[model samples]
Target: MYTKDKYSLRTVLLWTRRYIYIFVLISVIPVVLYQLAGWKWLHLPWRPIGLVGTALAFISGFKNNASYGRLWEARKIYGGIVNASRLFATMVNDFITNEFTENNKTDEELFLIRKTIIMRHVAWMTSLRHALRVKKPWETSGNNTSDKEHMQSIHIQEYKYTLEEELDGYLSDEEKNYVLDKTNKQTACLNLQSKNFKELKMDGLIEDFRHMEFKNIIGELFALQGKSERIKNFPYPRQFATLNSFFVWFFILLLPFGLMHEFEEIGISLIDSLSGNEIYFFIAKNFIWLTIPFSIAISWIFITMERVGDVSENPFEGMSNDVPITTISRGIEIDIREMIGDDKTEIPNPHPEYNNTQM
Candidate 1:
């Protein structure tokens, strides 16, 4: 996600430049037809266009609110994952002990078991984020030409590397093969974790009650994963999104037509005031052409708001403004590895930020 306090005006202009071109064309045409071609009948009643604009405002507000709700929900789900990862690491380090084992393993052996479980949990997170990053049919954040260009400067690690490459050191060769064979690798990773915890209990490395606690934690992870998947799988209602676009465009097209007569009246008033000055009277006579820039500015606001809602609707689409799942997962790995006293050199560093953006 963008880490800066605000996006610069230059950046916003660059991202929406294409729409500006369209708006200028849409606005200029009616003004040219009215002023130059003498099509005075082109102007529509101001009241009808005002009513349409008010309706468009309400629809746009509804869309943006719903989109923000989805984005916030996705972030909270990952927040839960972050907390659960830390708790799991602490439990593996402290709860499993030789105090209850008849055949005690060495401290080094115990450490190895703790490291394995922790590392496997990292694999689970990696799989889950990669799964979310996979593009859905309805997701359109980076699909447009302008968005694709904007995303070039932002690094999305999931797009660059294969899941197998990412899981190399985290999963054992046999476990990697088992996970790769499954369609849902995240689910497979969690199943391996569950089996490992059960075996640890069977061998008396963990108490029976502690085993139950571990199971509970696993169940929570499953719930969190399911929540994430639900958002990724189901998109914002297409009917609303589609209709919102249509309404915004309808209003933009009607704006210049409505402004024609409004500006004409303003020009007439100005001409009357400047009647004694030749130069001022000439400038005032052509004041109706001011509709072009006014229409462009107003239309830009509506179109930009529509685009904001569109991009925010899918928080996992790898856009710069979406949730930084890659960075969050890497951070969790770092924190949990440190909890287990793993060598600092062995643990991977946090993912780098690009252009004040994380992904």
Candidate 2:
């Protein structure tokens, strides 16, 4: 996610400029009809429009809260993965031993076993992250033309490498091919891990209780993976999203008509306050035009609120605002590999941030 202190006014304005153009037109059109065409009947009473604005605020608040809850839950699930991965790696390095084995193995043999198992876990993480990054029909950051244009300016590591190629770094050729052939490659990787873990149990390298513990960690990892996939596959309800957009635009379109009547009356009263100076009368009467900018600014506030929630609902879409799952996955790899005695130089470097976001 974005790690900056705050999004500056310039950044917020630039990000939302497309919507601003539409808001300007929505505000100005009614003003033009009311003023230039002398369509006084088009000016609406401010009270009903004010009521709609209030309802819009309540609805937008509900949507944003629900969307943010999804994003936070996704983050927590990955947090669980990070913890469970480290625990599993430590078990690989420490739990299995010659303590119960028929033939005593050398330190080198034990170390090799630890490294292989940790690397397999790393492969599982890789496949799970790739699955999360896959675009769903409801996601906007990678799907829409305008959002795709914006994303082009930012670099995502997953986009730089193919899933098959990346899996090669952690999985054997046979294992990678087997996984690639499956519908859920991550699930396949987990099955491979469980199979290897079971073999260790059968060989007496790990005792029965220790084997059970290892399976439990794997089960936790599987649960975490499934949670993330559920969020990625099942979208926030489209009904709430569709109607939120319509209602926001509907309120904005009607906003200027109500504002114009209010501003014009204020302009006329101000003109009557002026002492008979022709220039002052002209300036005071024309002040009604200030409603255009006011209307645009207010409409922008409501629209921006709606847009924030819209984009936040899908946390794995590789958007700059999404949870930094790729970065988190890489970090876990580094940690687990280091625990298994891999050289620091052999480990890949951390993912670099793009536009203040790590993804």
Candidate 3:
């Protein structure tokens, strides 16, 4: 989701700060205490430490690989949604030609059908994005009434007024109000579209050509909806995740003890000649030196991998490197409106700030 020219080191560090702290605490504190206590008796076995370190390394690699796979899968699914949306727009435009030229439906009825379907498509995209992010769609909609008073105070009115004005005479007040109340505009639009399709069928306007065309478009929409749901519901395997995390933590915990056995047994004067107090200090110092930096490095890898998993699990959240759902949704709305031969101005552009960067 990040839109900058490149990823920032500052941002990466910020996201992984918590893990870094854990590594420092595990590695540094013990070493510092050892230096103060002058401990020299503490020691660990080299062979076991080496084995643990090796195992930890393997676990880190596997976790990174697994996380990347989830991220890539999420990307692919969103890509499919994008393609399907475009295809649906094309079908709608082609199938819903000036209905009067070949049918009994008036210009007004045909216009309503086209506009309603297009708007509904837009609403659906917004709703799906909200659902993915676990946010309320209505809250994000610019015309939300809870924020209406604030907008009014600042004299920063939104498009609600204009939309209402446009539909004034064509739709009843109740219908107009209903549309305005809808937070998931795209879903609402789709429902209207389905109803319109049924009406066309009942009125004998569902000629073979148009029927097939409309059916394909509806099919694409349904497919897109299913795909989004799949991404939301189906995540990476839980077993793999649990195993990888367990090994990583286990390795970190045992690392200091392993190093102590290997290095302390050397019996160098610094450790062997020390008095009781000094001996403890020496042992603790060695422990910390071995523990802190290595723990930090390993912990950093685990933390980064975990974060990658989190981002991958919800690709549509508009997070850094996550799918640009808001932009995609806006693009769909624009393309559909253009296809319906409506003025480009009728389709509101997404916020410039949001479109420019990954949230």
Candidate 4:
């Protein structure tokens, strides 16, 4: 996600330049036909176009609100994961003890135990982020030519490594193989964690109540996973998205037809008021051409709003505007490892950002 205070105007304009080109063409066609081609019938009435614009405004606002809701929900799910992970780490570090075990382990052995569970939790996180990054048929974040080119400036770490490769240092060979064999790797990792905790409980490493508490946290994580998967799997209602696009385009194409006439009338009034001034008359005579820029500006605003909703609808699509799951997962890993007193140097650095964006 963008870490800067806000996206620069240059970035926003560059990102939408291709669309602006199309808008320019769309706006120019009708103005040329009406003014130069002398096709008087090419101009449209303002009332009908105004009605369309008003309807388009409502739908655009609705779409943006829904898209923002999806984005915020995704972020909140990750926030819950962050909190649960911290709690899990704290419990694992302090609860497992000789107080409940007859066969006591050395301090080093206990630390190893704590480290193993914590790392597996990190593995679960890695698996989840990787799963979420998997492309769905409906996700179109970087599919466009412009977006594909722009994505080069942002680093998405999940694309750089396979799940097996990322799990290398975190999971044992047998566990890794077991996880890789599963349809849902994150669920598999969590299953492994639950099994480990159960074994620990049986061996008296934790009291019965504490074991139940761990199980509850595991269940909460499972619920959070499902929530993330739900959003990733099911896209924003395509009916709304598809129709919104049609409406916006229809409005853009119709804009210049209505706008050129209004400007033409204004130019006529100006020419009449400055009847004897040749320079003012010349300028006023051609002022109808200003419709091209005005139409483009209006079309750009509407189209940009529509595009914003489109991009925000899928928060896990690895776009610059997506949730920074990679960074968040790494931060959780760092915090959990520190909780267990892992060597500071051994913890990997946080994922690096590019162009003030993280993925």
Candidate 5:
């Protein structure tokens, strides 16, 4: 969702700083114990460590791949929505006509008809985006202040206003009340649309063919809606996410124990080679502390990768890395309204980008 070329280094570091602290603790504690207490027994061979790293890499790669697929598919579904919406708007604007009607309406009345249908579709978009942004129990982005701050830096700007508030301008008092009463407001809106199209048919505003085509587009919208809902309601398998973390952490905690002795051996050889050089010996003997940074670096990489997968699995969670469906919805709204020939000044602007992300 980041529309900037990438997250700033400062932003990335700040977002990962909590996990970095854990890594620092995991790396530093064992090094201190080994150095100060002469705990030579703390040393571990590298082969088993290498094996764990290799296995963890494979699983983590799979997780990331699956997560990215979820993210990309969600985006593609919304992209479909954008196209279908424009097509629907164009069809509605052109198909409904006075040609078939015995009691023909003026062009102004027809414009109002087109406006009503398109605006209801706009309301549906509003409701859908609102539904998507609802926090699930498993979602990581919640009401925490710090994470909220970072997310808003690149999050959906439309999330600020209540959907109800936005719906007021788009729906009549009766229509608004009808929609608000429903469990799935967007689905309710679509049903209203279908009913309206049927009424338009009875009134001879649209012929049978146009009515069926409208119904077909509504069906596609339903399919897109279900696809998004499936992703939102169903989660990635928990066992894989849970066990991957445990394995990565186990390997990271064990890493310094395995590598510190190897670094110490290197230090010893350095001192032997530079014999009688007091400065070099001092530097060589203290080189074991370098393992702290090394271990921290390695741990950060694995943990960050795992976290990325975790967050990516839920694209509707309103995280900075989410799919930006709200943004896409707004773009569709802007396009559909324009295509229907709504007054340019009356239409709202596209949702503003956050840190270059159009969320």
Candidate 6:
């Protein structure tokens, strides 16, 4: 995501530079041409321009409010994911009995089952993050958290690398095929974890009551994954987007003519010292040129803000303003491992070396 301090004059200028030619052609050149031809040819009533500007402003305000609502909703959905992930880990650690009962399964079996479920829970978080970002689960790499050794032992590396390479080769064929494959992998991983939990219950390593408790948490995690997918796939209405574009362009087009009427009415005043007509024309020329640049600058600001809201509404896109999904997944892994009697040393710390890498 963009830093909180990213909104500044320099940032605006940088964005403007990217679309400089278009702004000049649409907003600047016409005003300059009209000024050169003399202000008389451009004259139009100020009242109509004022009315149009007010209407455009109202539309822009409504659009911004609607976009922000979507953005907030997406953030709340991810918040649910974070809570559900923690709940899953907690249920696995606390609800399952470590000791064997009359059915005769050992503590070791129970431990293995719990650990496997925990790892799979971690995998689910990672998979969901990748899914929302439209990335393959295997494409991500690095020390997202401090527990590299445990992650490697679980075969996260080999599976990820192999799958990622295969995905990269297959992406050209059809995007849906690749997405379907990844989704299957996520489901398969969750199923394996669930099977391990069920086996423990059958063997009497965990009580039937405890097994059900953990299963409920797993169900919640599945629900959260579906919610994230909904946000990623569905977007705000296209008509709302079209409306905003139309109004912004209309306002720009009508501004120069609006100023022309004011100049014509003030024309007689210029003759007391100089020709009132010439003075009025000069005022009209300067105002029109000023309006062009000012309008372009304001439009750029609005466009940039709208674009940011668009990206933030689905924060899994690997864009600058997207949620740090990889980072969150790593945090879930570290937290689960630490809770399960693993030594703190075994779990990696957060905050890998930044070096020169861009976030």
Pick the lDDT winner. Answer: 1
Model 6 C-alpha lDDT per residue in residues 1-359, reported as the tens digit of each score: 23344444554354336444555566655555556765456555778777877777777677767766766666677677777767776777766674655654456765665666665566555555555655332211232221223234323222344434433422233432434466455565566567767877776667877788767766776676677677667765667766766776676566555653454344434434454466565764354456566656655755565545444444554443445555556666687777776657756566231211112
Give per-residue lDDT, candidate 5, residue 218.
Answer: 98
Off by over 4 Å in 3: 3-5, 98-112, 135-191, 202-206, 259-291, 350-356
lDDT of 4 by residue, 1-359 (tens): 76475765666787889999998899888888888889988888999999999999999999999999999999999999999999999999889998899899899999999999999999999999999999877776557666666666686778878998899999999999999999999999999999999999888999899999999999999999999999999999999999999999999989999999999999999987885888899889999899999999999899889887988898987877778999999999999999999999999998888887777
User: Each model's TM-score, in the order given?
Assistant: 0.96, 0.95, 0.70, 0.97, 0.95, 0.72
Q: Which candidate is the best by TM-score?
A: 4
Ranking by lDDT: 1, 4, 5, 2, 3, 6
Provide the clashing-pair count of each candidate structure: 0, 0, 29, 0, 2, 7
> What would you estimate as the lDDT of candidate 4?
0.90
User: Mind giving the per-residue lDDT tens digits that candidate 1 earns over 43-75?
Assistant: 998899999999999999999999999999999
Tens-digit per-residue lDDT, 24-74, candidate 5: 888788889899988878889988998999999999999999999999999
Model 1 TM? 0.96
Worst 10 residues of 1 by lDDT: 2-11
lDDT of each: 0.91, 0.85, 0.58, 0.90, 0.86, 0.56
Per-residue lDDT tens digits of candidate 3, residues 1-359? 54465545555675567667777777665555554566545445658766876776676567667656656776676677777777776766656654524456666776776676666666556545555655332221133232333223322112223444434443446555665678644355456667667766655656566776676677777666767666666665667666766776776666655554444444344565566797576664454465556657766766566556545545554455666655566666676677777766665775454323533
Per-candidate alpha-carbon RMSD to the true structure: 1.4, 1.7, 8.4, 1.3, 1.7, 8.9
Ranking by TM-score: 4, 1, 5, 2, 6, 3
**Model 4's TM-score against the true structure:** 0.97
Question: Candidate 5 clashing pairs?
Answer: 156-359, 157-359
